[model samples]
Target: MLVDLFDFALPPERIALRPAAPRDTARMLVVTPDALADRIVRDLPSQLRRGDLLVFNDTRVIPAQLEGTRGDARIGATLHKREGPRRWRAFVRNARRLRDGDLIDFGAGVAAAARDRADDGSWALEFAGDEPVELLLERAGRMPLPPYIAGKRATDARDADDYQTMFANEPGAVAAPTAALHFTPDLLAALAAAGVDHATLTLHVGAGTFLPVKADDTADHRMHAEWGRIDAATAERLNTVRAAGGRVIAVGTTSLRLIESAAGDDGVIRPFEGDTAIFITPGYRFRGIDGLMTNFHLPRSTLFMLVSALMGLERMQAAYAHAITRDYRFYSYGDASLLLP
Candidate 1:
């Protein structure tokens, strides 16, 4: 498949900068091979059968976008990945000018130094503190919102809470697991009342997920690696659900990728933890999930490609056109879709 085959046009107004006032009120596009239906997110349980399991990624979004001054250099950085408590992989501006042994002060007596290089043109910055890196970032950094949103001048006040999912717990991801964001505590209780069971997994979303396929051909586009894990207990629970003939519905691409990467047709999820660079495109048979709950994506993105794989390319392209015509929201903090394959 060629990367350009997934292309489509979207109006700028269709991008949603903020979520709906009531989270569950967001629209849901229901895509089955034979029919394309639409409904509100609150109607999820009715849309899904009773014997379906929704798998969600509980990785919390960190305030990983940080700013500091390297002696008037005025640097900006995002803690892209963790190396050690004292070390981190960060993307910095004016990177070519920066060399080993450059000190950047955060203006609060704490600082970091550019130590080395990681792949993808990222830098290794070592921080000064006994506190864990997560805690340090929590106090120092700002919410790493995507570049498209521009109303907010500073990422301080509302973003700290709004950018995270209601069920956020495991602290690692720089980006939110968007599908989980639509579910409120009240909505979960309602879904449970309607006989749906929820299981949690962790896949620390990395910078790679947002990268466009630079290669002309899909086969040549290198997949970006992100760290993920599924525990023994969660694996057992999933197996039990499968044995009972229930369907597994992944809540986001992150969860879907990790679940599919960890389990095969044997139908047992083993305890697996590590980096996964799995590139899923059309004609790739899905090994784990039967349903997917996800947000609408950018044109020609890896996410769009993943959607093309789930609901055939023809169906997906039509769906995107339909979404545009009906003025559905696009990208993170946008509307969602429930896919049954």
Candidate 2:
């Protein structure tokens, strides 16, 4: 399908620069197969049945943005994937100034050598020293905020906590699973009391999620791979939920994609580990998840395409139109939507 088909006009003011005061206070637009309702995140537990399970992505956001100097040229990089304990694949801003084997010096004694460059213009960088790359990043890196929000204002200390979800534990992701940011301890207790069971998986969301679709057609777009894991126990538990005739509700697109990647043609989810570059588009049949809770996405973005595939293209367009008119927020720090089709 033409990528232009997913395009929609969004007013700049509708983009949220900051999250709601109480995370659960964010607005949630529920789009069922036959109806649309306006609600808040705190109202989620009541939106579904007792036996339904909500799958959350437990991957934590890492400080992936870095600034350095290479041969007197200022360079910026956002680490998107881990190649090894000390090696990473990153998208560089001053990439033309870098070459294979060239060393770039990030301030505070941190440095890395560019090992290789991909056809897509990303660089393979291997950090210097053996103090654990995570430690090096802690000293030289900054939060990798989505460009939509960062472009409008500078990222600050508040974003350090706001960009992460309550379920964050395993560290690797460069980007936050925005939809899960609406969750809080109070909300979790309420959901449990409401009889909504929850589970967790890991998908290290990469900076690729913020990349724009340059392809004219959906078939030409190639999704960048992200690491994810689902243990045998979790898979069995999810299968059990399905067997008991309960719905599996994915908390974010990250969780939805990972679960779908682990599901078989027979719709049974199995233990999975490693990378997934699953690109969901219209006409794709979903097998693992019954519903999704995600943030409002960018125009012509892959996320919008995925939601369009979940619901219908026309229905999502209408849903978005309603959201816009009602003054709901948009993007990573924005409001959310509950999509059930």
Candidate 3:
């Protein structure tokens, strides 16, 4: 499919710079086959069925954005994936100034040597110290906000909490699974009260999620690999959910992609632990998830294409048009959408 088929115009003001004050108060657009309904995130319990299970991504966002200098040239790095305990793959800004073995100092005694540039132009950065890289990032790094938001304003201390979800525990993701950001302890209680169960898996969302589909056709595009894990117990439980006539609704695209990656042609989900570069587009068959809860995505993005694959492309286009006219927020720190095909 031509990438232009997924394109749409979005007003700049529609981008959310901050989250809703209470988080759950953010608007949610419920897109079903028949109609679209406007609701709030707090209304999720009422929207989903009693036997449905919502799968959440437990991967937590780290302070991965770094600004440093190599000689006289200023450089920026956003750690996207963990290659090892002391090594990470990062997208470099001002990368032309970097060499294979040159050391870039990120201040507060944090420095890394760059090497192994990939075809995507990202590099492997090996830290210089014996201390944990997490500790080093805590000292020298700030939240890696999406460029759409960061371009408008600065990343502040508030982002340290706002960007994370209630289910965030396993630390590794550069980007938060924003769909789960609307979930709070109170909301979870309501969901449980409504007999809606929840489970978690880890998919460390990378900065590559924010990268554009530079290819003109969907067939020519390649997705960046992100590490994810689903344990045997969790896999068994998810399969049981579907077998028992319960719906398995993924809370975000990250969860959905990982679930799909773990599922077989027969639609049985299995234990998985590794990198997934699954690129979901229209005409793709969904074997694992019954529904999805995600944010409004960028125009012509792979995410939008994924949602189009879940629901029909034309249906999603209409739904997005409805969302825009309704004044719904967009992107990370934005409103939500519950898509049921």
Candidate 4:
């Protein structure tokens, strides 16, 4: 399909610079097959059925954004995928100034050598130290905020908390699962009271998620790989939920994609742990998930295409139009949308 089919205009002022004060107070747009409803994030329990299960991505957002210098040239790096214990694949800003063996020094005694460049222009960076990369990152890196948000304002200390979800435990993701950001302890209690169960999987969301689809056609686009894991216990539980006639609703696209990657054509989910570069577009058959909860996406983005695959392209276009007119927030720190097709 033509990428332009998913294009839409969004007002710059509609972007949210900060989250709702209480988190769960954020607005939600519920999009069903035939209707759209406006509600708040705290009202999720009432919106979902008693037998439904919400799958969350427990991947924690790390402070992966780094600014360093190789000689006189300034280099910026956002570590996306973990290649090894001391190696990571990162997208660099001043990549043109880097050579195969050039070492860039990030202040605070952190430094890494640039390795092989990929077809996407990202390079493998092997840190130079015996210290755990996480510790090194903690000393030298800042939160990897989306370019849309970071372009408007600087990343601050508040983002260390605001960008993470209550379920964050496994630290690796460069990007946060924004849909789960609307969830809180109180909200989870309410959901439990309503008999709605939740489960978790790990999908270390990469900076590639924020990359725009530059290809004119969806067929020409290539999705960057991200690491994810689903244990046998979690897979079994998800299957049990569906077997009991409950709906499996993914809390974010990250969870949904990982679930789909683990599922066979028979629609049974299996334990999986590896890199996934699944690109979901319209006409793809969904096997594992019944619904999705996600934030409003950018124009012509793969995320919008994924949502369009779940709902129809025209339907999502109308839903987005309504969201825009209703003053709903947009992007990684934006309002939520519950899509059921």
Candidate 5:
């Protein structure tokens, strides 16, 4: 399909620069097959059934944005993927100034040697340190905010907490699963009291999620691989939910993609531990999840394509139109959308 088909006009003011206070206060636009309703994220319990399970991505966001210098040239790097304990694949801001084998010095003695440059323009970076690379990042890195928000303002101490979800534990992700940011402890307790069971999976979201789809067609767009894991116990529990005739509600696109990647043709989810570069587009059949809760996405983005695939393209287009007209927020620090097809 033509990528232009997913394009929509969004007013710049509608993009949220900051998240709603009391997280759950964010507006949620519920898009169902037959109806569209405006609701609050706190009203999730009333929207879902008792037996339904909400799967959340537990991958924690790491401080991955680094600004440094090599000689006189200023360089910026955002680590996208972990190649080894000390090696990472990063997208460079000023690629023209760096070369393979160039030593870029990130202040505080944190530096890395640029290795192979991939065809996509990202460079393989090998960090120099005996201490864990996580420690090095703590000293030199800042939270990797989505460019939509970061471009408008600088990342601050507030974003350190705002960009992460309450379920964040296993650290690796460069980006937070934005949809899950609406959840809070009070919301979780309310959900449990409302009989909504929840589970967790890990998908280390990379900076690739912020990349624009420059392709003219959906077929030409390539998705970056992200590491994810689903344990046997969790898979068995999810299967049991399906067996009991309960719906599996994915809390974010990250969770949805990982679960779908683990599901078989027969629709049974199995234990999985590896990388997934699953690119969901229209005409794709979903097997694992019954519904999705995610943030409003960018125009012509892979995430919009995923939602278009979940619901029909026309329906999502209409839904987005309604969202825009209703003054709902957009992007990572934006409002939420509950999509059920």
Candidate 6:
């Protein structure tokens, strides 16, 4: 299929700059194969049955954005995937200007020094501190806000809370599993009371999650790799749920991708601890995940393509059209949708 098929017009006004007050009070759009229901996230439990299992991605967003200059070229960079504690793969604004052997310095008081660029146009930066590089990123790095938002102005401290999931734990991700952003502890407790079971898997979301589908033919597209892990215990729990005929409801595309990547054709899941570049698109049969809970994504992005795989491309396009018409918010801190294939 052509990537352009997923294109649609989303009003700039619908792109939310901030999160909703009290979090879980945000809107939810539930779509079954036959019907579509508009509801609030607080009413999520009311939509679930007794035996479904909810799997969430618990990887937290780190302070991945860095502001510095390459000689006279001012650039904004987002540290995406970590190659090591000190080395990482990053996306910068003026990627061409920052050549190999060039040093881009962040302002004073920060303990860091930039290194030469890799052949791929990414920097190989190292830090100067007694603490670990991860620890330093927590202290000196800024929120890795998306380009759409950063274009408006600089990212502030407010994004410390806004650009993360409520269940954020293992920090390495440059981006949040946004569907989990609407969840609050109270709402999760409410789901538990309603007999919904929760499971967690870790998929460190990379800056690649923000990459657009540049290929004209979708089959030609290459997926970006990101670190993901499903421990033996979590896999066993999910497999047990499946044996009991329970639905596997993935909370985000990250979880859905990781679960499907780790499961066998028979739908049995096993422990997985490594990087995966599983690109999901339409026509792929789901080995796991009966339904998905995710935020609205970019028009021609890979995320939208994954949603197309679960729900039909035509159907998903209709849904996006509906969302646009209804003034539904789009992207990271936006409202969510529950899709049943």
Q: Estimate each model's TM-score.
A: 0.95, 0.99, 0.99, 0.99, 0.99, 0.94
Task: Give each model's whole-structure lDDT.
Answer: 0.84, 0.96, 0.96, 0.96, 0.95, 0.84
Clashes of each: 0, 0, 0, 0, 0, 0
Worst 10 residues of 5 by lDDT: 92-101
Which lDDT value does model 2 have at 118?
94
Predict model 3's lDDT versus the native.
0.96
Q: How well is each residue in 63-154 modelled by candidate 1, as lDDT tens digits?
A: 87777887657888877677776887888876776778898776555588898766667888999867776777767787888766644344
lDDT string for model 5 (1-341, tens) is 99999999999999999999999999999999999999999999999998999999999999999999999999999999999999999999898899889999999889999999998999988999798999999999999998888888999999999999999999999999999999999999999999899999999999999899999999999999999999999999999999999899999999999999999999999999999999999999899999999999999999999999999999999999999999999999899999988
* Candidate 2 per-residue lDDT over residues 114-216, each given as its tens digit: 9889989999899999899999999999999999888989989999999999999999999999899999999999999988999999999999998999999
Which pairs clash inside model 5? none
Q: RMSD to the native, candidate 4?
A: 0.6
- Displacement of residue 194 (Cα, Å) in model 6 is 0.7
Off by over 4 Å in 6: 70-72, 109-120, 128-130
lDDT tens per residue, model 4, 171-287: 999999999999999999999999999999999999999988989999999999999999999999999999999999999999999999999999999999999999999999999
Error of 6 at 210 (Å): 1.0
**C-alpha RMSD between model 1 and the true structure:** 1.6
Q: Write one digit per residue (lDDT tens) for candidate 6, span 147-242.
A: 777777678878888888878999899988989999999999999999998999999998888877778988998887999999999999998887
Q: Is candidate 1 or candidate 4 better by lDDT?
A: 4
The residue-level lDDT of candidate 1 at 276 comes to 87
Q: In model 3, where is the ten-residue run with the lowest total lDDT?
A: 43-52
